[model samples]
Target: MSHSPHNIRTASAEARGRGATAALLIAHCAGMLDLVALPVWVGAALIGSMGLAPAQAGLLVTLFLAGQVMASLVLAPRFGRWPAQRVIVGGFALATLAFASLFLVQTYVLMALLHALGGIGAGTALSCVHGLMGRSANPHRVFAMAGLALGLFGILVLGSGPVIVEKAGAATLFVLFALATFTAAVAALMWLGQSQSVAENQADSSAPTSTQLKAPIPKVVWMGMLGIGCMSLANAMLFSFVERIGMDRGYGLQTVTSILIGVGLFNLVPPVLAALLEKRLAAGRVLLAGPVCQLLLALAVTQVQSLWLFAFAAVVWVGVMIFTHTFLFGLIARLDTSGRALAATPAMLMIGSAIGPLLAGVLVDASGYQGLGLMVAMVAVLAFGCFLRLQWATDNRAAVVPRSSH
Candidate 1:
């Protein structure tokens, strides 16, 4: 009944692979917590603690996002040359240090600078994780898992962040972020070595030559990146103001927070559903459904004043966004194969996010929330058009090959 040596080695390798995947997922979740949750959690703190206006408080978030975009754009393409594990560890260490230093700084400018530096660290960690995930055996599944982790983490942070801020002050949350990164760094240390093997093997067998690795990607991939950027832009615009929107509709703070938590909880559903359906359905069809649903839901949320109805729309909108993002990440991975596009995913998302609030604010000032919703819905429509064109291009190119073979 004893297993052979080869079987033992295979089993050990599989276990290590699972361990590595878990480590990456945890690290990714921790790295993204600030991106998804910090602005909402710290907005009031930033204003109250620093005596800044709401607009100025928002600027801190903008600086942080700008840092992320800058780092991801600059660092993602170097995954082939640099060791991902080292980058991840270094990024986490730097972020943890920055977060820990927040308590020592009092000025808005200094805090903004620290947040930006921390963002660079977080962005580096995220890009490395994305590169690793892109080159994984199952990028779609990894992304879905990562999305689920982030959603669950979002719920936990959203639920607890308010309490922590109220009782302990906003600065405590930064310490918590540092602890989370430290935990991720520990996890990374456990399994990141395994990731090196996976990366090396993928590089060796997939390309076999520098030319193939550096080959030109099609224009459709760039278009798809733009499309994703638009989607993120619209999403950030609405999401950044969602609580305010609810409060403006006469819901209390507690009610708005509850609604947001509900939305975050619902966010976990779509990625799981997408992962399950990915094998059974055409990815193109699934991809196309996401934005269409989002557009309808965006319009619905704006039109309805009922808290229950708006909550329902918000949940569904979040789910659709997650589904769309998972599919899009998969598409980019497939398109590039070199992981560069995958690395750019966070940058594209951050770029849209950075633009979203500005655009939404302008639209709201000119025409109110109704106008904002309409503008975002239009952006979604345009994004859907981009995806449709991508699908058509892919299908047409595929059709050409068989005819040429004949």
Candidate 2:
């Protein structure tokens, strides 16, 4: 009852830190949900509600993702200079308004415009989130926490999104997207405001500030980003069509929806596993293996006729990307302590994601699911090559350290 003023100040600062962390988690989850719920957004809303052809629907999603890539690329370099609170609040508010506007628009052109606007806002917020993570004391674990939050969000989206879209129509789903971003914006406004005490505490917990934020990112970090982009491309290429694949294979709506739920439930693993194995596992080997696993799974899900096999492959397809990308995110954070490279995380991931759906759509229309597999095979080859180079660079760096120390 007789606490000193210093003790009270410390407690308040700790509370603000916790609040900031919570805000970050919510922002990360909300900002990333479009990519997370790709199957529903692309398959159900665009194809089912809007009655767009596969390639056309894919193009709509591609436009949104391209906007995200462009915004993140433009904002990430300035992330260190801008205030995080303003970026997050402004970005999510714009996204919320854009998503909410979808309820009033029916034309494909109008919807596409809104989607691109929403993507720009979401991408700006995401850059801030990733930049904060990169500057954290433990980027790997922080990114893992964000991934873990996304897993929970994914479960809700996959579990309920189909039912909601089925009952209330696609407009309702867009409304929900607006609601999610609005929540993040409000949370950021309340918790991540430019409070000096919170800022000081965050700075204390962050990595050293000696790194020049404007310095060019190292080549190894660029390779790592390329590896992530390829993996993301391969992932979204098949994932955006998981529901359609099931339907095309003659699976009933109920059965496919159940399998999608299974996919969400299974997604809860990799981030936790990555956090646990942060130091124990070899990142290079995981990076090398991730693309191969993704390719095999893509082929399995695409080529298999068996209901159980397809369901199993679809359920676990995203986990490998989550696991490998966690390590890659951490690696890039270490390589580029300035945080600019990590701030471009959305750009790195979404550039390929933007291409994935349209490319897959073209392939599927031309040569069927088997053609999609071939495309994934080619992308996986590029991913493997990038990761191989990353591994070599990491090994060379490790070898040089001991010699330089001596």
Candidate 3:
């Protein structure tokens, strides 16, 4: 019995879909591992082992994010011209080298430079994955899966990272990061090419352009990006200093860590829930719900004195973050079909993450945790307004197009 041509094509498509999913998951997990793990361990190492001032340690993280912003702005837009697989594999290789170089560096400046380089690698890998997801059949589902993978990694790393740092040293964390990136690099070799093909095919089918020209990005897309950035900023402001806040409330380090672990474990819930709910609710509604929940939670935490209450708030905060991020990326995909908007997501998020701590630090120094909470609440309100406008703009655009066609 001979297989029909249509049957063969269906089987081929199925194989490609599986390969693309695997590649996207691996790339996303690799790209985000450093983002999640480095903040936990590297900041402590800089202060405890290297004797850097807290401000200087903060600057190191900023420089690393600066590298990511630079790459997302400079390299990601050019993915259409470059081989996606090569870019991803090269990014992993670069990240591995940068992490390994951390062991050799003793000077603050050198370490900062290496961290920035690693950020570039991470940004590149992340941009490739985002572009691929945006071009896939269902970007919302892809992003949800990506969140789930990151949450799982966060659980393992947050659970064991401090122990590793305590037992061996902070430098060993870099070694583990190197090994993770190397593993991702190896896996990338197998599936990234297939994923790239899927992206190209989708691009051709959706918007075939002469000489690879792209539609001009709309203003609403930029607004959506700004909204996500603000949301991230508000979230990070409190999150970056949650441990200090707990300590100020008289919780011990062990208790604070336990709360954080619970936060990490609870991280797994939102993405899975978002994936299920994406079909039931409008994406804009889901996006709007996140900041609303966050603002209310932030207000509640400000008045709560109990450690358990704070822990509950922290877990809910993580859930809101995962939910917001997944839907926000999906919104970008909808706003800009060319994939540029989604590719810029990491840059926007990193920019906000980079700014939040600095601003929050200043607020805490001047006004204390209560003041910080108030300011974060205000920011969340602003973010919600942005999302509201984005929804309106999207609706108006949809309305205008059909009317103009008539």
Candidate 4:
């Protein structure tokens, strides 16, 4: 798939615009960076590394995805008329408040409450940061930035957070995270300017200039959401529980953690490559891999129990997850040039994300890690079947469009 340099001119204009887009992503996601591993790292320190149960630790992510679902479903639309910056700032403010509570709150209930709030903040921030990416002169560059950020944070959390915990303790980490998120939120509003507001951005540039306006959803787009959802569900299940899976199998907790951290390095590779191939492969080509990867990885799980086997499975499996996510966003942005409807796509992805984790949790509670992995693998099979149906439908639709117009 031609995912990169779609129409790249070696000229400075493209390069300059890319620089500006990366700056915007960094500025907007600062809160994200500031608190990257704060919750888990801090929790590990305060709760005692052994004190943090796998399910409990997984809940932190689960709750966050739940908030993302609720926010995406409820809050996102109401703010459709606001600037993307408003959401960014509000998310940061909320995250800061949550972290501030962490500085003192010690009860599990209290931590859950704050984490739930932080998830909402994370959901809002992610949705908006992604929306901002839609405005880039080169959308792939923005995707690359996102991949870079996620990878960097993974490194910080998996690698550096442990060091910080060893030296400074959890409370100190909370205070630092609070400061950083607050700074990011402030910077987003100040630097992005007011013109980037959602209400002001209704001009439909993606449509033919002579084309009549209609509500933005095309059948193709909804189908795209399905694929995206499947990809994220796999990612959430794997990311939140992969360590649990490894540890249960006999690896040391520290070794499993290190393996998970090593994941960040690969996470960086896919988006850059996907962006390069995006133009060459239609968005569907990239998204179609979601189910394909899931199908193989699911069986792969049955075969491989060793640490190396899990690691090997992760490489392409993670790529499939990243492919679905990155391309889904790219496709949604293409379909809805108007900033408002486009905003919902992130929320949809989050919704899928929430479902995956909750299901994983339920399965784990019932059957343990191996069973949970198999259940997720089943879901992947179902999602792949859906992808095949959608692919056929899309081809049929493309075939009919010319005849219908004539």
TM-score leader: 2
Give residue 184's error in model 2 in angstroms. 1.0
How does residue 45 of candidate 2 score in lDDT?
80
State which candidate, 1 or 4, has the greater lDDT: 1
Q: What is the Å distance of residue 224 in model 1 from its true position? A: 1.3
lDDT of 2 by residue, 1-406 (tens): 6999999998887788778778888998888886579889888888876678889889888887888899999998886677788988999999999999998899989988998999899999988878877777678888888888888889889888888888888888898899999999999999985641223355634533545665777888888899899999998899999988988888988998898888788778999999999999998998999999988898888877889989999999888898999999888877777888988999998999989888888888899888898788789889999999999998998777775552
Screening candidate 3 with a backbone cut-off below 3 angstroms (N, C-alpha, C), the clashing residue pairs are none
- Models ranked on lDDT: 2, 1, 3, 4
| TM-score of predicted structure 3 | 0.89
| lDDT (Cα, tens digit) per residue for candidate 3, span 6-70 | 88887876676677677778778777663355435433355444655545666676666667777
Q: Identify the runs in model 4 with alpha carbons over 4 angstroms from their true place.
A: 1-20, 27-56, 75-80, 162-180, 197-214, 298-303, 315-317, 402-406
- What overall lDDT goes with each candidate model? 0.74, 0.85, 0.73, 0.59
Q: What residue runs in model 2 are displaced by over 4 Å at the alpha carbon?
A: 195-211, 402-406
Q: Which candidate leads in lDDT?
A: 2
Candidate 3 worst ten-residue window by lDDT? 204-213
Candidate 4: tens digits of C-alpha lDDT, residues 1-406: 4534534433333454344354455543443342234224423453345366545655655666677667655544443345666777888789889878987887888887897897688567656665556644444556666766666655666565555665776666667667767776766766655555222223321222222123555666666667566666765665455545565677765765576466656667777777777778776666566777776775565446666777667545555666666766666565555444445545555565656555665667777767766766777776766666666776787787775552
